[model samples]
Target: MNKMHDFEASLQVLRGSETDITSEVNVIKTAVASANKRTAIRFQELNQKKFRMPLILGIGLLVLQQLSGINAILFYAGSIFKTAGLTNSNLAACGVGAIALLATGVTTWLLDRAGRRILLIVTSSSL
Candidate 1:
């Protein structure tokens, strides 16, 4: 009985004498609409900014990374094969690199819809 009275008092404070249930519902809906509008405006502003420049920068970086021989061992793997007792380590390394690249692309495709936070967590832990 005491708890029931406390609950009724809290409900009265939530409703007040002037505010009704419909007004409370409208307030919640307005808050959601405001949030959505703010998000849409943010997206519009981003679209109005330098979006194509990011693509050009990305392509330029990829070209530089590929042509610059950043990973010399990967680019000239024949020397590694000669140093070791292996005969075709270069071709084997190339095949392994191709398989790893394919697997990474597939994982990236899956991560698009599976949420980035989970992938970030898993990938960081893997590192």
Candidate 2:
């Protein structure tokens, strides 16, 4: 109740004198109702046949992402580099770490612009 009052106070401050607490409360109620409707619709959609492919693809992608050996490689990178005849194994490991960070940043930037299908194809192919 105290948090709700604080939220109302902040909202009142933002709206200035244009609206009252009742209006703010009504607005919140409307938003909640809208979200509930959307949730119900999504739940219904999940039961339909059309959504099956997408649901399977999402699950498969998640499983593949986990099963990939990237974590193990990163964990044993130093020894791997040493075994591969690198004189400075630490420097090689650091290079791998830098590449991983840069790849993550690049992937984030590309995801929104290139879209998921294209990005996934590119990343999977590169592997």
Best-matching candidate per TM-score: 2
Residue 71 displacement in candidate 2 (angstroms): 1.8
**Model 1, range 1-127, lDDT digits (tens) per residue?**
2364555456657878565555555575577668767434454554544766766656775776676674886765666776876778778778768987998898989888788778756754553
Q: Please identify model 2 stretches exceeding 4 Å from their true place.
A: 1-21, 24-51, 125-127
Global local distance difference test of model 2: 0.83
Clashes of each: 0, 0
Residue pairs clashing, model 1? none
In terms of lDDT, the poorest run of 10 residues in model 1 is 38-47
Best by lDDT: 2
Model 1: lDDT of residue 9: 54
- Total clashing pairs in model 1: 0
Q: Write the per-residue lDDT of candidate 2 for residues 2-116, one digit (tens) a residue.
A: 3777777788888785777787687896787787674345665786898888998899888887789777898999999999999999999999999989988998998878899
TM-score of each: 0.36, 0.54
